[model samples]
Target: MPAVVVTNHGGDVPDFEGKITIYVIICVFIAAFGGLMFGYDIGISGGVTSMDDFLKKFFMNVYEKKKHVHENNYCKYNDALLQLFTSSLYIAALLASFVASRLCTKMGRKPTMQIASIFFMVGVGLQAGGINIVMIVCGRIMLGIGVGFANQAVPLFLSELAPAKMRGALNICFQLFITIGILAAGIINYFTSKVHPHGWRISLGLAIVPAVILLIGSFAICETPTSLIERKNLDEGKATLKKIRGTEDVIPEFESIVAASEMARQVKNPFSKLMKPSSRPPLIIAILLQVFQQFTGINAIMFYAPVLFQTVGFGSNASLLSTVITGLVNVFSTLVSIYTVDWAGRRILLLEACVQMFLTQTVVGLILLIDLKTTGSLNHVEAVIVVVLVCIFVMGFAWSWGPLGWLIPSETFPLETRTAGFAFAVSSNMLFTFIIAQAFLSMLCHMRAGIFFFFAAWILVMGLFTLFFVPETKGVPIDSMVEKVWKQHWFWKRYMVDADDEEIKEQVHPHVK
Candidate 1:
């Protein structure tokens, strides 16, 4: 017999059975395959560009022909072009996210994800078989567009479908798979780097496997209940709610969705409404979190770990191995957040992780600075310390911003403005990511040890921001607007105090649990 569970709103539901939980987990995992594609696309280029064969064939061919440069100069020119190539995807992603915001609302989440997967597959096909630089750049843009769509859709889809109790953990599937994808790419790069001209091709083409799986799997999942309700298909929404919840009594949840949708419909302009004083806190928090996540320099670390390791006196094989270790630490540490996010809450974890990252980044910078001042290169012990600090820094990020960056924005906005809100947040993320990716190698060239110091300072500022501004949203209902949810906080108390005491009392009481 299935156990019965009750909601705070005086409604009963069937406790989820093991089989139903498995089904939901499978669906979430499939959607998260997009994260794997994102990771592979990101991780592949670092290793491929580093390959002598790949550079000589694709980049050095043009430069050497025009300028007749030496091998060393050719390598330097190749590195610069690689950075542009890497960042081009993110540039495309920024534009795609804006389009995705409208398309997701118009087409529904499932269909939107399918479209992204198709783009991913097409992009991978072109990249894997490309004969020229122009073809490769075009492919990267397509993949970026796919990534932009997945970035917005996957988290929102999971948040809407997950049970309230499991929402945080379920949504984090996106970040977890991203780490997994990175790890897989790192391992592939390690082996493929030993091969000749074809190794880079194999590393890139492998992304197609996951893209195909995601494209097919997208069709099997039900449309989100909230999206269905928003479309005025109330009956189908109720059915999806029941299917996802594995319970017959979905009226309480269904009515809550209807009410939230009605409230959202009342707003005339979402972008304008988001700017009003009442809604500004959540919007600001969402955007700043994304900005800080990229500024942490995590992507720079992940995408160029091999190069950074080489700069610090490691050989090519050692650098590649070290990168794989970073990927493993990233994947395992994220499980900590998955287990504890609901229990530990978002605010504290983010704060503590930021502090840890700040310390690690500072230590890494100091070590490099000392090496430059004294030995002119790292000794074995100093090299070990640098490796340890990098691993710890990645761990801190994995357990905090990497997952929370996606989770908070998806949960922060009201139903009506959610599409636009999340789109803006995700696009903000891509914009910063593009800046960091494009500028990182240049910073390394110009600043050297100073680059780490820059990141450490940013981490400190992010920590302060988290301490003062970010509100606790541990178990808040997804449909509740920020104004309603954070009315008791200092920012909203003055504005909301006299607006609707009776309604506030009723709204606040039921979600108190």
Candidate 2:
């Protein structure tokens, strides 16, 4: 039998004590800068495309009214057009993540990010200067390729590098930065929208500056030590791990990786192995989590926050201001998750967040229905409630799905299969994000108040799925968990039957040297 290898299996929090070096933190932060770019790119487009008055000067006025005010409180035909512009990037991301995953696996993480940054810089530059809508779409497609690559590579790099104890918290920094970027974009658009009719150009153009920064920053980051070992460069891999952890006792740690890599080699082509029968459960779980994460309607809110606020009767600036608040709430609450993840455990936190979201979403739907029925504008009370519920939903998402969805898949699979599994999961996520994101404006335009109910139903289903299916993976080390997952029954089922079982706990968390 192959030796039983344990990875990341040190005792609670203490094992990571000295490993949290400032240099390591800097590396994590840099890898997570891609999240900033992801947020900036996605969030800026929503408000930027609404620069209809400015865009009209360059192209034909697709709508009769300026973006500020319209006859029926909608932008007419151009509303759909602007939404398409914002969402097409997601469609491009859907395709690009698959390509990125394969390429990153071969090229190594840092180089992959460097290549991605080049795409982002070139793409966003083209977007800002594009004369026609089609040109902008092409630029977004290019931007999506870069974003897709970074989105796949960054969180995986950060999660794998983060010490086990601080892993969840550190990895979640990506999600927090994502919200910060969103809030920053919202604030930037709010202030700049009135300054120039072509304000969206500034917002779109700003992304390139960060892309340039990322291109430079990528060189300083150490490639993931795990990848080094997989390439059979053990000595350098040991040195890299020591540099990352700043520790001398890396040889004990090195043994686990060697055994794990050997197991990985046995399962070598991840895509091919996933096609076999044994991979079904993990594959299903991976795909389902990705789908559910997107279907929860988070993207709908983030992608069209200003419009959603407008639909609820807020003024243009007020709608944008509300978006800022939404972003702030998302950022802060994700911090709460960062602190609590190791303490409360993944499954519990996710369950609570989902329930809170379910209640809040249902209430929002009912309020919208009542307003539509009464022909009444949302009074101060209703508006406040709507804003609060939106914040609540943002909080729930930031804590649970936003980061955890990215973090968990990185932890769940063995090294050989991880990239492929994560690639598929991300691709599935982008696919759904594309579908929901592109159709959201059209759905809201056609369905009006009923869209909330549609999302409510989806959120409800997701909560039940979590209650029954999603496993609790708090404090579990990555290496042993892989072996235990193969030997033990599914974690959720085992936990459900015997929550206090000692053996399960030990297997989930074996002692590390």
Candidate 3:
């Protein structure tokens, strides 16, 4: 049997034996639905964009009866405005993530998720029937708020509640569900866009059903034990731990919770704390990982695949169909990551993904920049090359960076600062996402293939950074894993050690500092 080590608050670790619990998996699945929301929100807008012609036609009729408001009035309400229709959801998420770091801490995880679901349902409902852009933005914001809450809260909650052995796998489930959501949206859009005459509206409205289902699911769960301890409800906290831990002694677990909370309370300014010299390494890693994840060009592809295909000489329907294929590649690759993450480890997968992505994107950039030079036509071979590169890039991301980015931060963070740590990471992610989404359309217009080159360079940097700096985290227990990382000497060592060195056993477990 695998050895189990347990520790109480501010105490030396103790040993125990048990199997991983079902409750942890249950929580991961429920919370990961929030990722589904993220994916749905991200992809559903593309389908909505598909209906721009229909919308213009429908609104044109109304505008004609109103005596022609302006010659190009609806032109002002074209793709850019429709892009905002989807982009606003993420904008809302960016704001909500900041608020959530504070709110989730005070309100506790279960209640907060319930509240988010309510907002999600409300937002999706309003958005589907929204007559004006104003109403649409409002609905988008509602869903955004829920998404923001889930993004920060769910991963943080899952990390804290899960067993050390399974934390990485559990946390990656969030990303896995995101891929699943993207796939679902793509498939649904593909079928519905043909079957339903008003397909895009139906796609936008489908988000409401999932939100309602998640809301109902929340009632069957209990508050995280950590939150109970944070509130000084020791008896309830202990009982909750026992319920989850099952036959395992509760005192040590309860004590560990109290100790971590006490230690976290001392840090006061979580953001400021991250900037201190001692804390800077992890913060940089967290921030850079988020930056690279965005610049790896995943979202850019997802957001504008159809436009890209059209620009590369494909019809509108063909472009959408191609996007569905890309989404499938993404979903399957993510499932591969879910199966391999704990087995292959985070750092290895990250490095491998970055390298492969760099090569594929380089080919793609060259093909776009040189092969089609000064010509408006793309040859069949060149088109196939672009599709293959895009597929490979998506595969690399799905199996590595996509899931591991979310997993590593959850593992690296100390409990006291986990929420705040994730907040910074998530905020950094949003900042980059915002930058890319806002400017990518313009960049495609002006720079075109140059954008792929820019992202390829980012991937190259990400690959080198991961190779040198990112430590192997697979199978490492969270508390001990954190302690070990902090104990590393950044100053010149007498001799360099091998990259694959096994972590010192003593450094694998940590208590509340």
**Per-model TM against the reference:** 0.90, 0.89, 0.86
- TM-score attained by model 2: 0.89
- lDDT per model vs. reference: 0.80, 0.74, 0.71
Better of 2 and 3 by TM-score: 2
lDDT digits (tens) for residues 1-513 of candidate 2: 221122334333113322677778788878888888888876787676555554575434543543334333323333556656777777777788877777767777778788788889888988889888788888988888888888888877887776666678888888888888898889998887786666778888888866887888888889887777877888888888888777767665576667778767755477986775455555677788888888778888888787677667777788889988998898899999999987787888878877888788788888887774322357777887899999999999999988888877777766777778788887887788888877886776676667788887887888888787776666555655544453354543333233235336546875721
Cα lDDT, model 2, residue 371: 76
**Highest lDDT model number:** 1
Model 2 accuracy (lDDT, Cα): 0.74
Candidate 2 Cα outliers beyond 4 Å, as residue runs: 1-18, 54-62, 65-80, 373-376, 490-513
What's the number of clashes in each of the models? 0, 0, 6
- In TM-score terms, which candidate is top? 1
The per-residue C-alpha lDDT of model 3 at residue 447 equals 71
Q: Which one wins by lDDT: 1 or 3?
A: 1
